[model samples]
Target: MLLALDAMGGDRAPQEPCRGAVRACESLPDLEVALVGDGKRLEPLLAEVSSNVRSRLHVVHTEEYITMEDSPSVSMRRKRNSSLRLALDMVRGKEAAGCVSAGNTGAIVAGGVLVLGRIAGIDRPGLGVPILSLSRTSLLIDVGATVRCKPVNLVQFALMGSIYMRCLAGVPEPSVALLSNGEEDIKGDDVISEAREILKASSLNFVGYVEGKDVPVGKTDVVVCDGYTGNVLLKFGEGLGEGVFGLMKEEIRRSFLPKIGLAFMWPMLRQLHTRFDYEKQGGTPLLGVEGTVIKAHGRSKARAIDNALRVARQFVLQRGVETIREEVAKGGM
Candidate 1:
């Protein structure tokens, strides 16, 4: 399978994307990557790739590119030949199975909708991020795709999120929960209140509301919410994960005894760090887009880009889009 990658989309640019593509090719025997960016910039990085895996890497030239600060709507219209749009265009044209970008979230969503369009029954696409937990990861949908959504939109998000968790994560009957201030059914605002009724009547494993504190505990496999709230939660988790680790490091450096203790605890601490690492989570999928689209973090490096390709590959292999369409049709909402 061929995958389109925006080589110039992240903080590390062509270097990370190129190296990651090589790593992905090595890991997935059937995978090939199209690195979309300026050929001149990407050529040097490709040299660093091992000869055995080098044949799987190809570059698609494009000088035009979108910035992190560019308005998504404007950028979509203005930068037609941008690497991000071109990569997605490959998917639309069936030249690639999927596209991955570590760029601006809004720009990726805009380009995806404009280029690939949305699935027939999908009202709006949602950005679904996987949040790692003690037992398993939870899918947090609508992280930033649609800041303002209808009750029906939440229903669609729930259905799409559930399909993703089940198909990709192997959750046969994934539990779904609405993010709320309290566990009570009546806790959230009018949108959540109305959506709760619809989800309850649907065929999903509809668990009731889950508070912010309950999200990380992995009580539910899917956490559905408006984009405004979901994005805040996503950012909060990122900050908290890094902050806690930083505090631990500071304490470990305070004294010789604590430093010795750190050596004894290094293995467990490394495991915790790996669990909290955003790179390992890869990218968030923009569900409801006609083609597979992954929104990788802007700061992603080689490993993150590699994992994002893994995600795109799995999305295609598991038939995530088709599964969502089928589930939403049966959801009867």
Candidate 2:
């Protein structure tokens, strides 16, 4: 399968993304990547890769690119020839099976909606991140796609999230829950409350409200919330994980006895670290869009970019977009 990548989007653009394209093509022999960026910058990087892997890496040169600080509206209107725009264009034109970018989240969302359009019955496209919890991995939808959402939007997010977990994560019947302030049915704002009721009535395995703490403990297979809430929760969890690991490292350095203990427990510690590693998780899917769009972290490097490309490949292979369309149509949304 062929995938279009915005090589000039991330913080380590061109270099890391270029190397990542080569790595992806190396790992997935059948996969091909069209790196969209400046030919001059990317050519030198591509030249370093072995001929066998380099052959699978195609460069679609574009001098323009959307910056992290660029306004979504302005960028979409003005940067018509940008790497980000061209990458999405490739997906829209069916030149590529999917599009991957570590670019401006706002620009990706806006461009995705305008260029790819929304799937039928999907009011807004939600970004779904696969969060690893204590018991199992759960899908969090609307991590930063649509901040201000309506009741119908949250319900739609739940539907999309459930479909994602089922198709990609291999959950037969993913349990869904609303991320509310409390677990009580009466808790949450008007939007959450109304969405809860609608979800409960639907055919989905709606498990009612799940508090913020419940998310990390794997209370539900799919945690549904507005983009604002989901974004805050996701970032907080990232910071907390880093802080805890840092504390562990600091404590380990403070004592010789702990150092010896760490030697014995290094395997388990490494496993724990890998579980919370965002690099391994790669990117989150912008569900509800017409085509496959995976949003890698803006600060992504080679490893992260390679994994994100793998994710895009898996998403397309799993027929994620088509599954969501079928589910949404069945729900009569």
Candidate 3:
């Protein structure tokens, strides 16, 4: 299984991404990596790491690196061999099954749209983030891919996200829900209202409106929204988790008894942590596309990359994208 890793696109850049790729390679004996970046600088890091991952790592040179400060659309041209662009190229050329980028979201999305292209009849594509909660796992689309979308676009997003849950996540008949301000039919804006109406006519299992609170509650398997709202909701949930965990830590540190209790509950805490670990769920798969495009978080570490690579391998092996298109055509509703 061949996967391309963008080693110079995140805040941690070469070092972090390189280490993650090495970890992934070591973890998966059959995994082959085309690590894209400056080979000269990467060699030293490889020497420092103890693993024999160097044997499986294939270096793809990209002298120019994409920084978080660089404007994605224009900065892409500044370097003929930018890491993000090269990683996309590998996927486009079928040299690798997929490319994992933790760089500028704009560059990754733009490159995916321009280089990988969209699936037939898919007007726009959204980043589908799988949400794992206590009861179930669901998918939320347009986490940050498109800033805005129309009613038709929302309908398409719902269909694609639903199909993905069925094919990839194994939700036999995933329920589709429109992200709304309220459960009432007339509660949302015209765009969302119209999307709701259109989705009601869709062949998939349309389950009416889903509010923000229902998001992590797993009432629906697919939640569709414009990127503006989707991104805010996603970040909000993440922030809440962090805040609660911080408070819990502080409380535990306040007393020796609490510290002892925490130590005893360490296993449970670890299990709880894994429940929300994005790495365990893999990178957000870019749906409504011609091929698989897994976008790892910019701060992703070793385990995340390992899981992302596995996601790529799974998509190719199962022909996931093709099944999604077929399911959409059949209107899984």
Candidate 3 local lDDT, 51-143, one digit each (tens): 577778888876888888887677766655898888888888988888888788777777787788887778888888888876788888888
Report the CA-based lDDT of candidate 3 relative to the real structure: 0.81
Candidate 2, 8-123: lDDT as tens digits: 98899989899888889988999999999999999998777898988889999989999989999689879999999999999999999999999998999999998999999989
| 1-333 per-residue lDDT for model 1 (tens digits) | 999999989888878878888888998889999999999998988876777678888889999999889999899989999999999999999999999999878889888889989887888899988878888888888899888789989988998888888876888889999998999876999999899999999888999899988788888999999989988877887788889988887987776788888889999988887787654469888999889999888888788899999999988988887777776667533
Q: How many clashes in candidate 2?
A: 0
Residue 82's lDDT in candidate 3: 91
Q: How do the predictions measure up, each by TM-score?
A: 0.95, 0.96, 0.94
Best by TM-score: 2
RMSD of 3: 1.9
